[model samples]
Target: MFAPMDSTEIFWVATICVLLAVELATLGLTTIWFVGGALIALAAYECGAGMPLQLILFTCV
Candidate 1:
């Protein structure tokens, strides 16, 4: 059986997607760092991090 994805992971993935879309549209570096942060948070979530810890990891990145 497969475990369902957590909301936090979904949110992080969504954020990363949106940021990437914006980056693509603008062709600018702005928001790319945020995408990096979101990717890091997504990784944290995949590693079984809690929401609070994920947020902290995102902020740090």
Candidate 2:
């Protein structure tokens, strides 16, 4: 099955969600930022942005 949105965005968001859930379930600080970063990348991709911009956004957030 395929996502309704761009493939890159779908995968990244799914990965983000998975990471976030795991982080929450485990109560660990680790890996949450990476998941957030992926979410940032996914949003950037959907917005027609580039990797550099997404990285910047993720780092700043």
Worst 10 residues of 2 by lDDT: 2-11
lDDT of each: 0.87, 0.79
User: Model 1 misses residue 23 by how many Å?
Assistant: 0.7
Q: List, residue by residue over 1-61, the lDDT tens digit for candidate 1.
A: 9888767767888999999999999988988988998998898888888889888887887
Top candidate by lDDT:
1
How far residue 58's Cα lies from its native spot in candidate 1, in Å, is 1.2
Report, for all candidates in order, the number of backbone clashes.
0, 0
Task: Kindly list the per-residue Cα lDDT of model 2 for residues 1-61, writing each as its tens digit.
Answer: 9657766676777888888889999887887888878877777888899877877877775
Q: Candidate 1, 2: how far from true, in Å?
A: 5.6
In order of appearance, the predictions have TM-scores of: 0.81, 0.63
lDDT of 2 at 17: 83
